[model samples]
Target chain A: MNLRRKKLWMTVTLAVLAAAVILIPAPALAANPIERFVMVEASQYAFTPATLHANPGDTVTIELHSADVAHGIYVEGYGVSAEAQPGQPVAFTFVVTESGVFRLRCSITCGALHPFMLGRLTVGPNWTLARAAALAGLAVLAAPLAVRRETA
Target chain B: MNRVSLLQIPWLKAALKNRWPQFTISALLMAGFVFAIVAGLVGTPVGSRNFGIIAVWIAWWAILILAVVPVTGRGWCSVCPIPMAGDFLQRRSLLGPNGGRTRGLNLRLPKLFRNIWWQNAAFALMAIFSAAILTNPRVTALALIIMLVAAIGMSAVFERRSFCKSVCPVGGFIGLYSQVAPLELRVADAAACASCASKACYNGSEAGYGCPWGTFPAGLTRNPACGLCLECLRSCPNDNIVLNLRPFAADLEKPAARLDEAFKAFLMLGAALVYAAVFLGPWGNLKVAALAAGTWPWLGYAAAFLLICLALLPGLFWVAVRLAKRMAPAKPHTARRHDFAQAAAALVPLGLAFWAAFSLSFVFANGSYLLNVLSDPLGWGWDLFGTAGAVWSPLYGSWTVAVQVGVLALGAFGAARVAQRAGARGGLHPLPVSGYSLALTVVMMGLLL
Candidate 1:
């Protein structure tokens, strides 16, 4: 094929591939409801079992235990918080209404790295990450075709 | 391809020529800098509530990376306050040239240490201890004071702005990425500059001080060395100096020729990766080690940080360059060292993007602290703005991840274009370099998302 025709074909193919990636259907929801109980230990600047997973619409009961100082666990997207003192465990229950990754941060000042003390709550599959990965791959593939070759 | 001279605008030209406006801005910033030092030393130990930490790290850092560097190209350096005290001590007059009666030894910077190697080392040293300096207000205060004293000391001995040009850590990265900014200060008529005998731009002519950055306008071709101080414009008798708006990344069309600058790209890119993993990732042990500062784990962390920035990343890139050479050798047989430096130009955009993306997450999460700190600057419970009681909250939520992904994608594309241009110069293949950028982007995305 001629150069112009070849370029046109490549552009069209890339567009189709991008659409396929973006339009891919998410996994079907689970038919039965379930309850997940997780115990998270909070220390000076870390949370034990830093990541928690649950299905969308499932009830998640998180019991926070402070191993050292006073600490509070606040979940982003859920907007629920629980405070636990040393030797005392506080629990909060929230329904996972969405299907994305959320950060669980320390609501109370703990130490020097208090702001960065964090954990992840994943509900269902992390499709945002999957889609971002796909888009990034497509971006790398599309880059060379976007610029014309120039002679030195 | 076309350039519009900003000097043609009457009021801007007048404002730039007048030293008062620049001096006033620098003075205000210096006051803020002094206040930050005081706040850090005596204020509340809470880093989130301390003005020293929130204002400088969050507010100023966001503005420098997201707006100033990308839009103005070393514009921050034009009025930077760190060098103001030094300039004052050296010149003995702030308003004008002082009739060329400057003080100090006025010795030239040594030939061996003239390049940005000092800047690279200084920046690495700071990065190794950044977790502590970024978190503890006292450490931040000490770091700021050290920088201030270093600038004054360099100015007391060196001729002009040797600290900013070759020593300042932040200035080093700003200079490297300024190559992508659209704005440039250049001579409108090179012939005018060549014919002029006084050459007031580099030497004081009573109208203004000489180029603080120590660059000659006639030989200027890129944005890395030009601080955009406009001294040349104030001192030019023939009206030859002009600030122009041109295409972005215009300077990267010419490949990098210096090894120090090339290593700067590697260092910055590696820093972004390491910072993301340490600061934004869920690795708690890493954070502890980074903040422990001078302990065994911290020492190990520091060693790994330097090794990654100085050896591992650059080694991998060199291997890529070697692979490219084998895959597509230059017809004219370009030297490997030259090709390595030239190919590093592609990392400038990628590094800038990585920093911007990382800053977005950090800024959005902690930006609200700026309000509280503004009201209670010293955290002594003074509510100047009635925001001292403001609650802490993260802004934009999960949208930050989406925005970070978009920024990284744009950066990858820009880097690919630069790599393609470098490949066209006959030494390197674009694929390996572009692949390197793409892999880093994916890893960064994984970290942020």
Candidate 2:
């Protein structure tokens, strides 16, 4: 094929590949009708289960318990927060309205590494990871062809 | 071409030519350093609440990564406190020239040990122990004290900034990345430098000492080694030194690239990814391994960390480069490895973006402590700033997500452009070289998102 044609073909192929990767349908968020319950134990420097995964529209009722000193949970994006003392559990509920990862951080001054003490709330149908991976593949594949066209 | 020389501004020229501004800044930073060390030793042990940790890791580190390196290349180096004590001791003057006689032995650094290997090693060592260092004020203090003593000792033995040039871990990476910063200090005219007989920039003039970072400004092109001390500006007899505000990543366009620098790039990219996963990711096991000392899991973590940083990432990159070379329009006359090494510069922007994005995640999420710590730096219940009781809250919230994505995209584009330019200069198609950059973007996006 001619150089122009080759470049055209490569671009189209990249676009199609990227589209295919992104459109690889995972199970949709908010498909389930059940409420999710998880117990999160916060301590001086770490959270028990570092990640909590759920789907959009699912009610996630987290029972926050302090392993050591008093600690609080501050869920990002969602304005839900609570404080729990040692031997006392504080519960809070929030519906995952967004389909992305949100940080759940300690609101209290736990200890030395209190700042980094946190967890993740991954509301499902997180297509960003797939899309990013696909784009990367496309970029790698198309880059050489694009450079060739430039040089040509 | 998109640039104006800062020296053209009369006030800027006057300020740069004078020693007072830089001297004052350096002195202040040194004082802060001393305060940090004292506090780390005598005051609060809590890393989040301690002045030493909060000031150094939160405020200073956030600013350094987010602002200083991005806007002004090597600007921090000009006022870094590590070298202040050494410089003062060597010159025997805080703000004036020492009559061309330094108090130190003034010995030349050994030729065999030159280059950034020492810095790479030092940085690697630090990265291995960063978990411990970041969480403990005492450990942070010890590290600072060690660096200070080492800088002083090196100054006493070797001539002019041997420690910063060839030893400092932070300086090494900062120097490497500073190539992408718009600000640069270069001689105005090469002809003037060549024709002049005095060579005052290298050997001290009455106004200033010799280039402290052991570089002759006449031949300097990259920011990796130049500390931006501005000694050359004061010492230049021919009035050739000019500080230019040029386009970013100007130095990355240099015709030749080095393996050490390429390796540094890989190390940086890998470290940023691993740090993100360990420090920010929802992985408790990883953090445990990273933070736990003298355990099998910790050893495993360290080994994996080093392997990933030093080998796995580079190894993957090498494969990508090899694939690109095979598919390249023009076959390279040089060894494939050499070409791959040179092409590694293409990914520098992406690496920088990774660091920026990581810093964004880290600093924003934890930055609220700065207000509280400022008021209660020692966590001794002393509300010095009256803002000590400020509640912990992450800054910017989801706003950082959008900004990080934009930054990564810009970095990818820059990296691609760099690869194309480098390829054109080397009589090759640049596209193949961009593969690594594109792939790295994916990784960065994954981490950041």
Tell me the docking grade of candidate 1. medium
User: What is candidate 1's lDDT per residue for A1-152, written digit by digit as tens?
Assistant: 98878877887898898788778778878656699999999997878898898888899999999999999898888788998999999999999988888888888878778888888898888887788777777777777777662331
Best by lDDT: 1
Which tens-of-lDDT digit does each residue in B1-449 have in candidate 1? 68999989999999999989988999999999999999999999889889999989999999999999988989999989999989999999877687555789999999976899999999999999999998889999999999999999999999889999999999999999999899999999999999999889988688878888889999999898898888889988898998999877888888667889999998899899999889877779999999998899999999999999899988988998787777775555778888888888989989999999999978887788888999999889899989998977778466677788788887888888888877778567788988888888888887777
**Quality class of the docking in candidate 2, CAPRI style:** acceptable
lDDT of 2 by residue, B303-399 (tens): 9988998899888877766766666677757776677677888877778888898889878878878897788877789998789888777785667
Model 2 agreement with the true structure over A1-152: per-residue lDDT tens digits: 98799789878987788678756766665377569999999876677788888888889999999988999999988978999999999998888877788888888877655666768888885676666555555555654565566457
Question: Which ten contiguous residues of candidate 1 chain B have the minimum total lDDT?
Answer: B323-332
User: Roughly what TM-score does model 2 have, to 2 decimal places?
Assistant: 0.91
TM-score of each: 0.96, 0.91
Instruction: Name the top DockQ candidate.
Output: 1
Query: Where in model 1 is the C-alpha error above 4 Å?
Result: A12-16, A19-25, A29-32, A149-152
